[model samples]
Target: MADLIEKILSIEGGALAITRDTAAKLVNNLVQNGEVKPEEAQPLIDELVARGEAERDALREDLAAQVTTLQNTTQSIQTMLNANIKEAPERAIHELVLLGEQITNVQDRLREAEKQVEENTRQTLGQAQKQLRIAQARLVQATEEIRTGSIDEA
Candidate 1:
Protein backbone atom coordinates (compact mmCIF):
# COMPACT_ATOMS: atom_id res chain seq x y z
CA MET A 1 0.00 0.00 0.00
CA ALA A 2 2.81 2.42 0.75
CA ASP A 3 4.45 1.45 -2.56
CA LEU A 4 1.20 2.20 -4.45
CA ILE A 5 0.81 5.58 -2.68
CA GLU A 6 4.44 6.48 -3.35
CA LYS A 7 4.05 5.50 -7.05
CA ILE A 8 0.96 7.72 -7.34
CA LEU A 9 2.93 10.66 -5.87
CA SER A 10 5.89 9.84 -8.19
CA ILE A 11 4.17 11.04 -11.36
CA GLU A 12 6.26 14.16 -11.22
CA GLY A 13 9.79 13.20 -12.20
CA GLY A 14 12.64 13.76 -9.70
CA ALA A 15 10.27 13.06 -6.74
CA LEU A 16 11.98 11.71 -3.62
CA ALA A 17 12.15 7.89 -4.00
CA ILE A 18 11.39 5.82 -0.86
CA THR A 19 12.30 2.11 -1.05
CA ARG A 20 10.29 -0.50 0.83
CA ASP A 21 13.19 -1.00 3.25
CA THR A 22 13.33 2.75 3.98
CA ALA A 23 9.61 2.90 4.52
CA ALA A 24 9.76 -0.10 6.89
CA LYS A 25 12.65 1.49 8.82
CA LEU A 26 10.78 4.80 9.22
CA VAL A 27 7.63 3.04 10.40
CA ASN A 28 9.71 1.02 12.85
CA ASN A 29 11.36 4.13 14.27
CA LEU A 30 7.97 5.86 14.70
CA VAL A 31 6.50 2.80 16.43
CA GLN A 32 9.44 2.48 18.80
CA ASN A 33 8.91 6.13 19.84
CA GLY A 34 5.12 5.53 20.30
CA GLU A 35 4.27 7.84 17.38
CA VAL A 36 1.55 7.23 14.86
CA LYS A 37 2.43 6.26 11.28
CA PRO A 38 2.92 9.20 8.98
CA GLU A 39 0.31 7.83 6.59
CA GLU A 40 -2.26 7.82 9.40
CA ALA A 41 -1.01 10.91 11.26
CA GLN A 42 -1.60 13.50 8.55
CA PRO A 43 -5.25 12.73 7.97
CA LEU A 44 -5.93 12.46 11.70
CA ILE A 45 -4.28 15.80 12.35
CA ASP A 46 -6.29 17.46 9.60
CA GLU A 47 -9.55 15.99 10.84
CA LEU A 48 -8.84 17.03 14.43
CA VAL A 49 -7.98 20.59 13.40
CA ALA A 50 -11.20 20.84 11.40
CA ARG A 51 -13.26 19.48 14.27
CA GLY A 52 -11.60 21.90 16.73
CA GLU A 53 -12.40 24.83 14.46
CA ALA A 54 -16.02 23.74 14.16
CA GLU A 55 -16.34 23.36 17.94
CA ARG A 56 -14.88 26.80 18.48
CA ASP A 57 -17.33 28.30 15.99
CA ALA A 58 -20.23 26.61 17.73
CA LEU A 59 -19.04 27.81 21.13
CA ARG A 60 -18.72 31.38 19.85
CA GLU A 61 -22.24 31.29 18.44
CA ASP A 62 -23.67 29.93 21.71
CA LEU A 63 -21.91 32.61 23.70
CA ALA A 64 -23.28 35.31 21.40
CA ALA A 65 -26.80 33.97 21.73
CA GLN A 66 -26.48 33.83 25.50
CA VAL A 67 -25.24 37.40 25.64
CA THR A 68 -28.16 38.62 23.53
CA THR A 69 -30.68 36.74 25.69
CA LEU A 70 -29.19 38.10 28.90
CA GLN A 71 -29.26 41.64 27.57
CA ASN A 72 -32.92 41.39 26.66
CA THR A 73 -33.83 39.87 30.02
CA THR A 74 -31.93 42.55 31.88
CA GLN A 75 -33.64 45.28 29.92
CA SER A 76 -37.06 43.83 30.65
CA ILE A 77 -36.35 43.54 34.33
CA GLN A 78 -35.06 47.09 34.43
CA THR A 79 -38.17 48.39 32.71
CA MET A 80 -40.41 46.62 35.17
CA LEU A 81 -38.43 47.88 38.11
CA ASN A 82 -38.40 51.40 36.76
CA ALA A 83 -42.15 51.43 36.30
CA ASN A 84 -42.65 50.10 39.81
CA ILE A 85 -40.33 52.75 41.18
CA LYS A 86 -42.20 55.47 39.36
CA GLU A 87 -45.54 54.41 40.82
CA ALA A 88 -44.36 53.65 44.34
CA PRO A 89 -44.95 57.12 45.77
CA GLU A 90 -48.48 57.28 44.39
CA ARG A 91 -49.30 53.87 45.79
CA ALA A 92 -47.88 54.82 49.17
CA ILE A 93 -49.89 58.06 49.26
CA HIS A 94 -53.10 56.22 48.45
CA GLU A 95 -52.46 53.73 51.22
CA LEU A 96 -51.67 56.54 53.65
CA VAL A 97 -54.92 58.31 52.78
CA LEU A 98 -56.89 55.15 53.41
CA LEU A 99 -55.23 54.70 56.77
CA GLY A 100 -55.96 58.31 57.71
CA GLU A 101 -59.62 57.86 56.89
CA GLN A 102 -59.76 54.78 59.05
CA ILE A 103 -58.09 56.65 61.89
CA THR A 104 -60.63 59.47 61.60
CA ASN A 105 -63.48 56.99 61.68
CA VAL A 106 -62.10 55.40 64.82
CA GLN A 107 -61.71 58.78 66.51
CA ASP A 108 -65.31 59.74 65.71
CA ARG A 109 -66.56 56.47 67.15
CA LEU A 110 -64.56 57.06 70.28
CA ARG A 111 -65.99 60.56 70.71
CA GLU A 112 -69.55 59.25 70.32
CA ALA A 113 -68.89 56.59 72.96
CA GLU A 114 -67.50 59.19 75.35
CA LYS A 115 -70.58 61.37 74.89
CA GLN A 116 -72.88 58.42 75.58
CA VAL A 117 -70.97 57.61 78.77
CA GLU A 118 -71.20 61.23 79.96
CA GLU A 119 -74.94 61.34 79.35
CA ASN A 120 -75.49 58.12 81.33
CA THR A 121 -73.42 59.47 84.21
CA ARG A 122 -75.38 62.68 84.30
CA GLN A 123 -78.70 60.82 84.43
CA THR A 124 -77.49 58.59 87.24
CA LEU A 125 -76.34 61.62 89.28
CA GLY A 126 -79.72 63.34 88.83
CA GLN A 127 -81.58 60.25 90.01
CA ALA A 128 -79.38 59.95 93.10
CA GLN A 129 -80.02 63.64 94.04
CA LYS A 130 -83.78 63.20 93.75
CA GLN A 131 -83.74 60.18 96.07
CA LEU A 132 -81.75 62.12 98.68
CA ARG A 133 -84.22 65.07 98.62
CA ILE A 134 -87.24 62.77 99.21
CA ALA A 135 -85.54 61.11 102.19
CA GLN A 136 -84.76 64.55 103.83
CA ALA A 137 -88.44 65.66 103.59
CA ARG A 138 -89.65 62.52 105.33
CA LEU A 139 -87.13 63.01 108.13
CA VAL A 140 -88.34 66.62 108.76
CA GLN A 141 -92.02 65.66 108.97
CA ALA A 142 -91.35 62.89 111.46
CA THR A 143 -89.30 65.21 113.68
CA GLU A 144 -92.15 67.77 113.85
CA GLU A 145 -94.75 65.15 114.79
CA ILE A 146 -92.59 63.95 117.65
CA ARG A 147 -92.13 67.47 119.02
CA THR A 148 -95.96 67.99 119.18
CA GLY A 149 -96.34 65.01 121.63
CA SER A 150 -99.36 63.67 119.75
CA ILE A 151 -98.52 60.14 120.67
CA ASP A 152 -98.69 60.96 124.49
CA GLU A 153 -102.29 62.35 124.16
CA ALA A 154 -103.39 59.16 122.54
Candidate 2:
Protein backbone atom coordinates (compact mmCIF):
# COMPACT_ATOMS: atom_id res chain seq x y z
CA MET A 1 0.00 0.00 0.00
CA ALA A 2 2.80 2.38 0.84
CA ASP A 3 4.57 1.60 -2.41
CA LEU A 4 1.40 2.04 -4.42
CA ILE A 5 0.70 5.40 -2.77
CA GLU A 6 4.26 6.50 -3.39
CA LYS A 7 4.05 5.60 -7.06
CA ILE A 8 0.74 7.42 -7.42
CA LEU A 9 2.19 10.49 -5.75
CA SER A 10 5.19 10.47 -8.06
CA ILE A 11 3.05 10.28 -11.19
CA GLU A 12 0.66 12.94 -9.95
CA GLY A 13 3.55 15.19 -8.95
CA GLY A 14 5.10 14.94 -12.39
CA ALA A 15 1.80 15.70 -14.11
CA LEU A 16 1.10 18.67 -11.85
CA ALA A 17 4.60 20.02 -12.39
CA ILE A 18 4.15 19.89 -16.14
CA THR A 19 0.74 21.55 -15.91
CA ARG A 20 2.11 24.34 -13.71
CA ASP A 21 5.02 24.94 -16.06
CA THR A 22 2.71 25.12 -19.08
CA ALA A 23 0.39 27.51 -17.28
CA ALA A 24 3.30 29.78 -16.37
CA LYS A 25 4.39 29.87 -19.98
CA LEU A 26 0.87 30.75 -21.11
CA VAL A 27 0.66 33.49 -18.50
CA ASN A 28 4.01 34.88 -19.61
CA ASN A 29 2.76 34.95 -23.19
CA LEU A 30 -0.33 36.83 -22.06
CA VAL A 31 1.87 39.36 -20.29
CA GLN A 32 3.96 39.76 -23.42
CA ASN A 33 0.84 40.34 -25.49
CA GLY A 34 -0.48 42.94 -23.04
CA GLU A 35 -3.48 40.77 -22.26
CA VAL A 36 -2.36 40.57 -18.65
CA LYS A 37 -0.58 43.13 -16.51
CA PRO A 38 3.07 42.38 -15.79
CA GLU A 39 2.47 43.09 -12.10
CA GLU A 40 -0.43 40.58 -11.98
CA ALA A 41 1.41 37.66 -13.59
CA GLN A 42 3.31 36.43 -10.56
CA PRO A 43 0.30 36.32 -8.24
CA LEU A 44 -1.83 34.60 -10.86
CA ILE A 45 0.87 32.08 -11.64
CA ASP A 46 1.34 31.31 -7.96
CA GLU A 47 -2.38 30.80 -7.50
CA LEU A 48 -2.49 28.38 -10.42
CA VAL A 49 0.45 26.40 -9.10
CA ALA A 50 -1.15 26.14 -5.68
CA ARG A 51 -4.43 25.00 -7.20
CA GLY A 52 -2.71 22.31 -9.19
CA GLU A 53 -0.96 20.98 -6.10
CA ALA A 54 -4.22 20.94 -4.16
CA GLU A 55 -5.91 19.00 -6.94
CA ARG A 56 -3.06 16.50 -7.02
CA ASP A 57 -3.38 15.92 -3.30
CA ALA A 58 -7.12 15.38 -3.58
CA LEU A 59 -6.64 12.81 -6.34
CA ARG A 60 -4.00 11.04 -4.33
CA GLU A 61 -6.35 10.67 -1.40
CA ASP A 62 -9.09 9.31 -3.63
CA LEU A 63 -6.72 6.79 -5.20
CA ALA A 64 -5.50 5.69 -1.80
CA ALA A 65 -9.03 5.06 -0.67
CA GLN A 66 -9.69 2.98 -3.74
CA VAL A 67 -6.56 0.97 -3.13
CA THR A 68 -7.66 0.28 0.42
CA THR A 69 -11.07 -0.88 -0.75
CA LEU A 70 -9.46 -3.25 -3.26
CA GLN A 71 -7.19 -4.66 -0.59
CA ASN A 72 -10.12 -5.27 1.76
CA THR A 73 -12.09 -6.97 -0.98
CA THR A 74 -9.17 -9.27 -1.74
CA GLN A 75 -8.86 -10.24 1.91
CA SER A 76 -12.59 -10.95 2.15
CA ILE A 77 -12.42 -13.17 -0.90
CA GLN A 78 -9.52 -15.12 0.55
CA THR A 79 -11.38 -15.66 3.82
CA MET A 80 -14.45 -16.84 1.98
CA LEU A 81 -12.40 -19.37 0.01
CA ASN A 82 -10.71 -20.72 3.10
CA ALA A 83 -13.96 -21.14 4.98
CA ASN A 84 -15.67 -22.99 2.14
CA ILE A 85 -12.84 -25.14 0.83
CA LYS A 86 -13.43 -28.17 3.03
CA GLU A 87 -17.19 -28.06 3.57
CA ALA A 88 -18.34 -27.13 0.07
CA PRO A 89 -15.58 -28.19 -2.32
CA GLU A 90 -17.70 -28.01 -5.50
CA ARG A 91 -19.23 -24.65 -4.66
CA ALA A 92 -15.85 -23.29 -3.66
CA ILE A 93 -14.35 -24.40 -6.98
CA HIS A 94 -17.19 -22.75 -8.90
CA GLU A 95 -16.76 -19.56 -6.98
CA LEU A 96 -13.02 -19.60 -7.55
CA VAL A 97 -13.53 -20.08 -11.29
CA LEU A 98 -15.94 -17.14 -11.42
CA LEU A 99 -13.51 -15.00 -9.46
CA GLY A 100 -10.76 -15.96 -11.88
CA GLU A 101 -12.89 -14.89 -14.81
CA GLN A 102 -13.71 -11.59 -13.14
CA ILE A 103 -10.06 -10.96 -12.43
CA THR A 104 -9.16 -11.64 -16.04
CA ASN A 105 -11.84 -9.23 -17.24
CA VAL A 106 -10.57 -6.59 -14.86
CA GLN A 107 -7.00 -7.13 -16.08
CA ASP A 108 -8.10 -6.64 -19.68
CA ARG A 109 -9.92 -3.44 -18.82
CA LEU A 110 -6.88 -2.19 -16.91
CA ARG A 111 -4.65 -2.87 -19.90
CA GLU A 112 -6.96 -0.90 -22.18
CA ALA A 113 -7.03 1.98 -19.71
CA GLU A 114 -3.23 1.94 -19.49
CA LYS A 115 -2.96 2.13 -23.25
CA GLN A 116 -5.33 5.07 -23.37
CA VAL A 117 -3.40 6.86 -20.62
CA GLU A 118 -0.15 6.34 -22.54
CA GLU A 119 -1.65 7.75 -25.72
CA ASN A 120 -3.14 10.75 -23.95
CA THR A 121 0.12 11.46 -22.15
CA ARG A 122 1.97 11.36 -25.48
CA GLN A 123 -0.46 13.78 -27.10
CA THR A 124 -0.35 16.17 -24.13
CA LEU A 125 3.47 16.16 -24.04
CA GLY A 126 3.62 16.85 -27.77
CA GLN A 127 1.24 19.79 -27.46
CA ALA A 128 3.14 21.21 -24.49
CA GLN A 129 6.42 20.96 -26.41
CA LYS A 130 4.89 22.78 -29.38
CA GLN A 131 3.60 25.56 -27.15
CA LEU A 132 6.99 25.92 -25.49
CA ARG A 133 8.70 26.20 -28.86
CA ILE A 134 6.28 28.90 -29.96
CA ALA A 135 6.86 30.83 -26.73
CA GLN A 136 10.63 30.58 -27.18
CA ALA A 137 10.41 31.84 -30.76
CA ARG A 138 8.35 34.83 -29.67
CA LEU A 139 10.85 35.63 -26.93
CA VAL A 140 13.69 35.50 -29.45
CA GLN A 141 11.80 37.79 -31.81
CA ALA A 142 11.15 40.28 -29.02
CA THR A 143 14.80 40.20 -28.02
CA GLU A 144 15.90 40.94 -31.61
CA GLU A 145 13.45 43.83 -31.87
CA ILE A 146 14.78 45.31 -28.64
CA ARG A 147 18.38 44.93 -29.80
CA THR A 148 17.63 46.60 -33.14
CA GLY A 149 15.40 49.33 -31.57
CA SER A 150 12.77 48.43 -34.18
CA ILE A 151 9.21 49.49 -33.50
CA ASP A 152 6.33 47.42 -34.81
CA GLU A 153 6.23 48.69 -38.40
CA ALA A 154 2.49 47.88 -38.60
Candidate 3:
Protein backbone atom coordinates (compact mmCIF):
# COMPACT_ATOMS: atom_id res chain seq x y z
CA MET A 1 0.00 0.00 0.00
CA ALA A 2 2.82 2.37 0.81
CA ASP A 3 4.51 1.62 -2.51
CA LEU A 4 1.27 2.15 -4.37
CA ILE A 5 0.77 5.49 -2.68
CA GLU A 6 4.33 6.50 -3.54
CA LYS A 7 3.81 5.56 -7.16
CA ILE A 8 0.63 7.61 -7.34
CA LEU A 9 2.38 10.60 -5.83
CA SER A 10 5.26 10.28 -8.26
CA ILE A 11 2.88 10.17 -11.20
CA GLU A 12 1.07 13.26 -9.97
CA GLY A 13 4.37 15.12 -9.53
CA GLY A 14 5.52 14.03 -12.98
CA ALA A 15 2.35 15.31 -14.54
CA LEU A 16 2.82 18.74 -13.00
CA ALA A 17 6.45 18.82 -14.14
CA ILE A 18 5.40 17.89 -17.64
CA THR A 19 2.82 20.65 -17.67
CA ARG A 20 5.38 23.25 -16.63
CA ASP A 21 7.89 22.07 -19.25
CA THR A 22 5.23 22.03 -21.94
CA ALA A 23 4.28 25.62 -21.11
CA ALA A 24 7.91 26.69 -21.33
CA LYS A 25 8.36 24.88 -24.64
CA LEU A 26 5.32 26.63 -26.09
CA VAL A 27 6.72 30.04 -25.16
CA ASN A 28 10.13 29.10 -26.56
CA ASN A 29 8.51 28.00 -29.80
CA LEU A 30 6.67 31.29 -30.08
CA VAL A 31 9.95 33.14 -29.70
CA GLN A 32 11.68 30.91 -32.23
CA ASN A 33 8.86 31.48 -34.73
CA GLY A 34 9.12 35.23 -34.19
CA GLU A 35 5.61 35.37 -32.77
CA VAL A 36 7.12 36.57 -29.50
CA LYS A 37 10.17 38.76 -29.05
CA PRO A 38 13.28 36.79 -28.05
CA GLU A 39 14.03 39.10 -25.19
CA GLU A 40 10.56 38.60 -23.78
CA ALA A 41 10.43 34.82 -24.11
CA GLN A 42 12.03 33.82 -20.82
CA PRO A 43 10.05 36.30 -18.80
CA LEU A 44 6.87 35.27 -20.57
CA ILE A 45 7.56 31.61 -19.83
CA ASP A 46 8.30 32.43 -16.21
CA GLU A 47 5.13 34.44 -15.90
CA LEU A 48 3.13 31.68 -17.52
CA VAL A 49 4.51 29.09 -15.14
CA ALA A 50 4.01 31.32 -12.13
CA ARG A 51 0.45 32.12 -13.12
CA GLY A 52 -0.33 28.48 -13.76
CA GLU A 53 1.06 27.40 -10.42
CA ALA A 54 -0.64 30.23 -8.62
CA GLU A 55 -3.96 29.48 -10.27
CA ARG A 56 -3.66 25.80 -9.45
CA ASP A 57 -2.81 26.59 -5.86
CA ALA A 58 -5.69 29.00 -5.60
CA LEU A 59 -8.11 26.47 -7.05
CA ARG A 60 -6.91 23.74 -4.72
CA GLU A 61 -7.24 26.01 -1.72
CA ASP A 62 -10.66 27.17 -2.84
CA LEU A 63 -11.86 23.60 -3.28
CA ALA A 64 -10.57 22.59 0.15
CA ALA A 65 -12.15 25.60 1.76
CA GLN A 66 -15.45 24.99 0.03
CA VAL A 67 -15.44 21.38 1.12
CA THR A 68 -14.73 22.37 4.69
CA THR A 69 -17.44 25.00 4.61
CA LEU A 70 -19.95 22.53 3.25
CA GLN A 71 -19.03 19.97 5.88
CA ASN A 72 -19.54 22.53 8.60
CA THR A 73 -22.84 23.59 7.08
CA THR A 74 -23.96 19.98 6.91
CA GLN A 75 -23.11 19.48 10.57
CA SER A 76 -24.95 22.61 11.49
CA ILE A 77 -27.99 21.47 9.56
CA GLN A 78 -27.87 18.11 11.26
CA THR A 79 -27.72 19.82 14.64
CA MET A 80 -30.66 22.01 13.74
CA LEU A 81 -32.64 18.99 12.57
CA ASN A 82 -31.99 17.22 15.87
CA ALA A 83 -32.91 20.33 17.89
CA ASN A 84 -36.00 21.25 15.82
CA ILE A 85 -34.70 24.81 15.32
CA LYS A 86 -37.23 27.23 13.81
CA GLU A 87 -34.66 29.08 11.66
CA ALA A 88 -33.01 25.94 10.18
CA PRO A 89 -34.53 26.31 6.74
CA GLU A 90 -33.66 29.96 6.53
CA ARG A 91 -30.08 29.28 7.63
CA ALA A 92 -29.67 26.62 4.95
CA ILE A 93 -31.03 29.01 2.37
CA HIS A 94 -28.59 31.68 3.47
CA GLU A 95 -25.67 29.24 3.19
CA LEU A 96 -26.71 28.30 -0.34
CA VAL A 97 -26.85 31.97 -1.32
CA LEU A 98 -23.35 32.50 -0.02
CA LEU A 99 -22.09 29.45 -1.96
CA GLY A 100 -23.70 30.79 -5.13
CA GLU A 101 -21.90 34.09 -4.68
CA GLN A 102 -18.60 32.31 -4.23
CA ILE A 103 -19.18 30.39 -7.45
CA THR A 104 -19.93 33.62 -9.28
CA ASN A 105 -16.74 35.18 -8.01
CA VAL A 106 -14.68 32.24 -9.25
CA GLN A 107 -16.37 32.39 -12.62
CA ASP A 108 -15.67 36.09 -12.92
CA ARG A 109 -11.98 35.54 -12.20
CA LEU A 110 -11.80 32.77 -14.80
CA ARG A 111 -13.40 35.04 -17.41
CA GLU A 112 -10.91 37.78 -16.69
CA ALA A 113 -7.99 35.38 -17.10
CA GLU A 114 -9.38 34.18 -20.41
CA LYS A 115 -9.78 37.73 -21.66
CA GLN A 116 -6.18 38.54 -20.76
CA VAL A 117 -4.95 35.52 -22.71
CA GLU A 118 -7.08 36.49 -25.72
CA GLU A 119 -5.73 40.03 -25.71
CA ASN A 120 -2.13 38.81 -25.51
CA THR A 121 -2.73 36.44 -28.43
CA ARG A 122 -4.20 39.25 -30.49
CA GLN A 123 -1.18 41.46 -29.83
CA THR A 124 1.23 38.69 -30.83
CA LEU A 125 -0.68 38.00 -34.02
CA GLY A 126 -0.76 41.71 -34.85
CA GLN A 127 3.01 41.91 -34.52
CA ALA A 128 3.45 38.84 -36.70
CA GLN A 129 1.18 40.30 -39.36
CA LYS A 130 3.07 43.59 -39.37
CA GLN A 131 6.39 41.77 -39.73
CA LEU A 132 5.00 39.72 -42.61
CA ARG A 133 3.84 42.83 -44.44
CA ILE A 134 7.25 44.47 -44.07
CA ALA A 135 9.00 41.34 -45.32
CA GLN A 136 6.61 41.05 -48.26
CA ALA A 137 7.22 44.67 -49.27
CA ARG A 138 10.98 44.21 -49.11
CA LEU A 139 10.74 41.07 -51.24
CA VAL A 140 8.71 42.92 -53.88
CA GLN A 141 11.22 45.78 -53.97
CA ALA A 142 14.12 43.35 -54.34
CA THR A 143 12.36 41.45 -57.13
CA GLU A 144 11.60 44.65 -59.03
CA GLU A 145 15.18 45.90 -58.72
CA ILE A 146 16.54 42.60 -60.02
CA ARG A 147 14.14 42.62 -63.01
CA THR A 148 15.11 46.23 -63.96
CA GLY A 149 18.81 45.34 -63.85
CA SER A 150 19.30 47.78 -60.94
CA ILE A 151 20.91 44.88 -59.05
CA ASP A 152 23.08 42.90 -61.42
CA GLU A 153 23.42 39.11 -60.90
CA ALA A 154 26.97 38.00 -60.22
Candidate 4:
Protein backbone atom coordinates (compact mmCIF):
# COMPACT_ATOMS: atom_id res chain seq x y z
CA MET A 1 0.00 0.00 0.00
CA ALA A 2 2.83 2.39 0.81
CA ASP A 3 4.60 1.46 -2.39
CA LEU A 4 1.46 2.16 -4.41
CA ILE A 5 1.00 5.54 -2.77
CA GLU A 6 4.61 6.40 -3.44
CA LYS A 7 4.24 5.40 -7.06
CA ILE A 8 1.10 7.50 -7.44
CA LEU A 9 2.80 10.53 -5.97
CA SER A 10 5.78 10.13 -8.25
CA ILE A 11 3.86 10.63 -11.48
CA GLU A 12 4.40 14.01 -13.20
CA GLY A 13 2.81 15.79 -16.15
CA GLY A 14 3.65 13.87 -19.35
CA ALA A 15 2.20 11.57 -22.02
CA LEU A 16 1.00 9.05 -19.41
CA ALA A 17 1.33 10.88 -16.11
CA ILE A 18 -0.77 12.88 -13.66
CA THR A 19 -0.91 16.59 -12.98
CA ARG A 20 0.80 18.24 -10.01
CA ASP A 21 -2.49 19.27 -8.42
CA THR A 22 -3.77 15.70 -8.36
CA ALA A 23 -0.51 14.37 -7.02
CA ALA A 24 -0.57 16.93 -4.20
CA LYS A 25 -4.13 16.07 -3.26
CA LEU A 26 -3.37 12.38 -3.16
CA VAL A 27 -0.51 13.08 -0.78
CA ASN A 28 -2.74 15.30 1.30
CA ASN A 29 -5.33 12.57 1.70
CA LEU A 30 -2.73 9.99 2.61
CA VAL A 31 -1.39 12.34 5.25
CA GLN A 32 -4.85 12.99 6.64
CA ASN A 33 -5.44 9.27 6.92
CA GLY A 34 -2.17 8.79 8.77
CA GLU A 35 -0.89 6.70 5.89
CA VAL A 36 1.81 9.26 5.21
CA LYS A 37 3.58 11.97 7.17
CA PRO A 38 2.63 15.59 6.56
CA GLU A 39 6.29 16.50 6.37
CA GLU A 40 6.80 13.94 3.61
CA ALA A 41 4.49 15.83 1.26
CA GLN A 42 7.02 18.56 0.46
CA PRO A 43 9.72 16.17 -0.70
CA LEU A 44 7.25 14.25 -2.82
CA ILE A 45 5.99 17.45 -4.39
CA ASP A 46 9.54 18.53 -5.21
CA GLU A 47 10.31 15.20 -6.79
CA LEU A 48 7.20 15.36 -8.97
CA VAL A 49 8.10 18.85 -10.16
CA ALA A 50 11.58 17.68 -11.09
CA ARG A 51 10.16 14.75 -13.00
CA GLY A 52 7.87 17.05 -14.96
CA GLU A 53 10.77 19.23 -15.95
CA ALA A 54 12.72 16.22 -17.14
CA GLU A 55 9.83 14.94 -19.26
CA ARG A 56 9.44 18.37 -20.88
CA ASP A 57 13.15 18.42 -21.69
CA ALA A 58 12.90 15.01 -23.29
CA LEU A 59 9.90 16.00 -25.39
CA ARG A 60 11.73 19.12 -26.62
CA GLU A 61 14.70 16.99 -27.63
CA ASP A 62 12.47 14.53 -29.49
CA LEU A 63 10.80 17.38 -31.41
CA ALA A 64 14.14 18.89 -32.36
CA ALA A 65 15.35 15.50 -33.63
CA GLN A 66 12.24 15.09 -35.76
CA VAL A 67 12.80 18.53 -37.30
CA THR A 68 16.41 17.63 -38.02
CA THR A 69 15.29 14.44 -39.77
CA LEU A 70 12.85 16.40 -41.96
CA GLN A 71 15.57 18.90 -42.85
CA ASN A 72 17.92 16.08 -43.87
CA THR A 73 15.27 14.54 -46.10
CA THR A 74 14.67 17.87 -47.78
CA GLN A 75 18.42 18.29 -48.39
CA SER A 76 18.63 14.81 -49.88
CA ILE A 77 15.81 15.59 -52.30
CA GLN A 78 17.52 18.79 -53.37
CA THR A 79 20.78 16.88 -53.96
CA MET A 80 18.91 14.37 -56.10
CA LEU A 81 17.52 17.20 -58.23
CA ASN A 82 21.02 18.66 -58.70
CA ALA A 83 22.37 15.28 -59.79
CA ASN A 84 19.67 14.93 -62.46
CA ILE A 85 20.15 18.42 -63.93
CA LYS A 86 20.19 17.04 -67.52
CA GLU A 87 16.74 15.35 -67.08
CA ALA A 88 13.59 16.77 -68.70
CA PRO A 89 11.78 19.36 -66.56
CA GLU A 90 8.62 17.21 -66.37
CA ARG A 91 10.55 14.20 -65.09
CA ALA A 92 12.43 16.34 -62.59
CA ILE A 93 9.18 17.77 -61.37
CA HIS A 94 7.83 14.24 -60.84
CA GLU A 95 10.84 13.30 -58.72
CA LEU A 96 10.42 16.45 -56.70
CA VAL A 97 6.76 15.62 -56.08
CA LEU A 98 7.72 12.12 -54.89
CA LEU A 99 10.26 13.58 -52.48
CA GLY A 100 7.71 16.08 -51.22
CA GLU A 101 5.30 13.18 -50.65
CA GLN A 102 7.94 11.45 -48.52
CA ILE A 103 8.42 14.61 -46.48
CA THR A 104 4.66 14.89 -46.01
CA ASN A 105 4.57 11.32 -44.75
CA VAL A 106 7.13 12.18 -42.10
CA GLN A 107 5.10 15.20 -41.08
CA ASP A 108 2.02 13.01 -40.72
CA ARG A 109 3.85 10.61 -38.41
CA LEU A 110 5.12 13.49 -36.27
CA ARG A 111 1.62 14.88 -36.03
CA GLU A 112 0.32 11.49 -34.91
CA ALA A 113 2.98 11.29 -32.25
CA GLU A 114 2.03 14.74 -31.04
CA LYS A 115 -1.64 13.82 -30.90
CA GLN A 116 -0.91 10.64 -28.98
CA VAL A 117 1.13 12.56 -26.46
CA GLU A 118 -1.59 15.13 -25.99
CA GLU A 119 -4.43 12.64 -25.63
CA ASN A 120 -2.51 10.43 -23.24
CA THR A 121 -1.64 13.39 -21.03
CA ARG A 122 -5.21 14.61 -20.93
CA GLN A 123 -6.59 11.19 -20.05
CA THR A 124 -4.04 10.55 -17.37
CA LEU A 125 -4.67 13.95 -15.80
CA GLY A 126 -8.40 13.28 -15.78
CA GLN A 127 -7.94 9.95 -14.09
CA ALA A 128 -5.70 11.49 -11.49
CA GLN A 129 -8.18 14.25 -10.79
CA LYS A 130 -10.95 11.68 -10.39
CA GLN A 131 -8.87 9.71 -7.94
CA LEU A 132 -8.11 12.83 -5.93
CA ARG A 133 -11.79 13.62 -5.63
CA ILE A 134 -12.48 10.13 -4.36
CA ALA A 135 -9.72 10.50 -1.83
CA GLN A 136 -11.06 13.83 -0.69
CA ALA A 137 -14.52 12.33 -0.21
CA ARG A 138 -13.04 9.59 1.87
CA LEU A 139 -11.25 12.12 4.02
CA VAL A 140 -14.48 14.02 4.55
CA GLN A 141 -16.29 10.87 5.54
CA ALA A 142 -13.57 10.00 8.03
CA THR A 143 -13.79 13.49 9.53
CA GLU A 144 -17.55 13.23 9.91
CA GLU A 145 -17.18 9.89 11.61
CA ILE A 146 -14.78 11.41 14.12
CA ARG A 147 -17.12 14.28 14.86
CA THR A 148 -20.26 12.17 15.27
CA GLY A 149 -18.60 9.23 16.96
CA SER A 150 -21.10 6.98 15.18
CA ILE A 151 -23.77 7.31 12.47
CA ASP A 152 -26.46 6.45 15.01
CA GLU A 153 -25.18 9.18 17.35
CA ALA A 154 -25.28 11.71 14.53
Best by lDDT: 2
> Of 1 and 4, which scores higher on TM-score?
1
Scored against the true structure, residue 53 in model 2 reaches a CA lDDT of: 76
Q: How would you encode candidate 3's per-residue C-alpha lDDT over 8-90 as one tens digit per residue?
A: 33554532343557657766776788877878766665655665577678779999999999999999999887776757787
Candidate 4 regions exceeding 4 Å error are 1-6, 9-18, 82-154
Query: How well does each candidate superpose onto the true structure, as a TM-score?
Result: 0.62, 0.45, 0.40, 0.43
lDDT of 1 by residue, 71-103 (tens): 999999999999999999999999999999999
lDDT: worst 10-residue window of model 4:
9-18
Tens-place lDDT digits, model 2, residues 98-120:
99999999999999999999999
Off by over 4 Å in 2: 1-18, 89-154
Best by TM-score: 1
lDDT value for model 1:
0.67
Alpha carbon lDDT at 95, candidate 1 = 99
RMSD of each: 12.2, 49.0, 44.0, 49.6
TM-score of 4: 0.43
In candidate 2, what residue range of length 10 has the lowest lDDT sum? 1-10
Candidate 3 or 2, higher lDDT: 2
